[model samples]
Target: MKVHLLIQRTFAGLNTEYTSNPAIAQLDNKLFLTDERSVVMQITENPVFSFAKNEKWTCYSFIKRALDREKRAGFYAVRLFISSAHKLTNVKDCLLTIAQRYEFFIQNNTPSQEYTDLLTQINEKAIIEKERYTFDIESIRKGTYYAIATAENLEALFADERNEFVEKLYLFTTNIDSKLLAEFHLHSIDPLSVVKWQINDEKKALDKLWLENTAIPVFAKKLLSLQGAKLYFQLKGQQEKRELTGTNELKTTALIIDDADKCITSLKINNTAVKPQPYFELYALATDTLYYTLKNGKEIPLPITAKLSTRKLIVENSENALAKLWVNGEELPIPTGKKFEIYALTTDKIEYTIVGQAGKKTTVNSDIKTLSIHLPNRGQTINDNKKSPVIDILLYALLSLLVGGIIGYFYRSNTSEEDISAIEQKIQEKEAKYEQVKKELNSSQILPNNTATKTVTSTTTNTIKSNNTTTKTTNVATKTTNTNSKTTK
Candidate 1:
């Protein structure tokens, strides 16, 4: 079941990809697969590299070698264009099936309905093997599933699948209209690579595809050596405004985040968790380069797995009195008393409950912009700490007294003209009243009762204290009752 895809030797950064699904090529009804045709050099290594001469000589030598090799080794071999998953248990039947399909198409220019039904049945019943190779009539292994790689000085046909930390690949080209991914020269495929890009000398980001197949694992190793790269690619859909209905089966743009550096403590895509291939980069691209339209109506070179980071969330609370914290309806495990800068999205709903005699819940949505999560003090309730009623009343009373005293002190301290005049008038009136009282005492001879003059002189005193000192006032009044009989003096 070996097949060949039309590709060309490129002269810059190489990109390798493949696909088992027919929709990726936008040819669900029809598929194109071929056998290894005429070529000159070994299909794996670029023959141009053999000649360290000028670029022109390099390409010339490579193609010449391929042509020579094809003439020497070309033979009729059984190749297949299968759409189903199957094992090569019976090689004779499989080859016959391929021949039948090819012959029928050559005669009718399209597969008959019966032939299409057979293809579907084969795909369904095929026992897909992991090695990606098919056994011949002699049980010999041949790469049945493989990919085509296009890059600088390299046009290779390999069967090994890339299992690395490559999430997605971006193929940038000046040729915005070029639909197919091919070598810069070949024209046999439906659409060829006529795209050009104005890249700089540093090559910050050249026209890159999803996975550099072997290059990614090599880069993954390098990334591990450098403690990992924060680079990422996200899975995207092919349509711009496609609804996210559950039935719409979305595919990953690229595949695998092969833990090059082991920094990713966790990984999830669209809610499905996937493990990364350790010590590798991205799995090799299975199909050709794909393009997806985004919501902005712009054609992005995508539908590949890409790099995206998890949002950070930090938890802080007084005494760390937090029990359960729910985020977006999911309880997020918060370790006790552990100082860590965790990450989560801010748009996600955040709520928490305190731990104590009464566990109360609270929200973490005060500052959505800032990433910090600070919970209230453990004892601090949503309605502040409850105080005793007595204490509250005392506090209020003290506050009122203090205010009244302040007002009185200020009023007494101010010697306004009006206050002075009022005081003087009172003093004059008091003096006049004192004079009148003296006259009355002289004219009326006001007297007290005279009885045995019980002069039991009792001294009474009233004391008023200010700060720490006391002022005393004493008053004495004697009353005598007159007796008609002489007092028994």
Candidate 2:
């Protein structure tokens, strides 16, 4: 429920100055506050109260006069805009409380912030302090609404227009107890004249206890009449009762298991614990939807059953979190301090994969009741086994090269120019002498030159570059001659 508050100050021979917490539109202010009927000119025994509604909003206005020397100077109009379903009685006490406080502020000459503070308090009280049952009202079809409420004497607001209330009958149910008390307020554009009411297909004239408010008999297996209690109606075609019970066992076949050891653990639904049976055939409700709580304190509704009925899969991540786990290309969030559980219905198979596992897909047969998977640990992601070896090898090679470059840099930086020159000269001398010795050995080993020869060549070259220094070495390219006539020397 949302409450929009607007306050307007109107004095004789002066333009109306208005302020609203949520900033109501000028048209709404004119309709609910600045209008002559809403503004009280004189102090009266009873405060002026009125209701106005538009296409999108309904306004409740209360006017209270501030007295100066027992003479009426001006008046303040407090208008509340809310959903059409809420009644003025719901906020009457709060309205009076605010009016009395305003009277105090006027007498004491309080600042403007006090008004803002008062509006904030009232808004908070209406939204947070006052508690109301959360009802799931769904329109099944034209003129037919299916609602689930937790408490008795639950009143829901519906439009009185023919287009909105096209059907003659509406259905309601309560899960807390068999008894369900309901009131339907058929509101129209004009509140004074609401359409007449009737009961059932008989067209019996159901008396309107108040304008736009009517109470009908409670619907049960057996007909029962009570004040403000409307009877539940059966589905158009089905004979079975559509009554949903909180604890009554509808069916028990699904199981929740640990992924690590395939052991069954106790189940917790919405923070309530349920012990498993001996064979772990957990009792499940005959409902299509279930909720999973995320680690970030958010609840996500997931489907328990798929299109097909026979094939059912109960999947849970008991050992690891499912934040990065993907099922059929959909990411499954990890539950906070609980195992992530789901009852999925499938036609053939359920395909799932780890996020970083490089498309390593796993398939579970629809016939199988349980699924085993190694989910990623909390705050961690699954690594791809196929890509890890190459990554490791590259990392090792890079580290070796980096270390060698650093050593070479420091050695060169510490050496003088003279020492470097001396080292280069010594290396050149050693290379020249080695080449001369290699040439003499090659000449001595060659066979006689008169025969036809076949030549074979082998070459080796090595190069290392690091830290602004490059060294290249070429090994001897061996040439062997195989003659037709051997040992002809």
TM, every model? 0.23, 0.26
Alpha carbon lDDT of residue 89, candidate 2? Answer: 38
- Name the lDDT value of residue 16 in candidate 1: 15
Model 2: per-residue Cα lDDT over 172-271, one tens digit each: 2222122221222222222222222222321121212111123223221122122222322222212332332332222322333222322223334334
Model 1 RMSD, rounded to 1 decimal: 25.4
Which candidate has the top score in lDDT? 2
Worst 10 residues of 1 by lDDT: 456-465
Question: In model 2, which regions exceed 4 Å deviation?
Answer: 12-18, 37-45, 66-74, 85-89, 115-121, 124-489
For each candidate, the alpha-carbon lDDT, in order, equals 0.30, 0.39
- Candidate 1 has an lDDT of 0.30
Q: Residue 266 lDDT in model 2?
A: 34
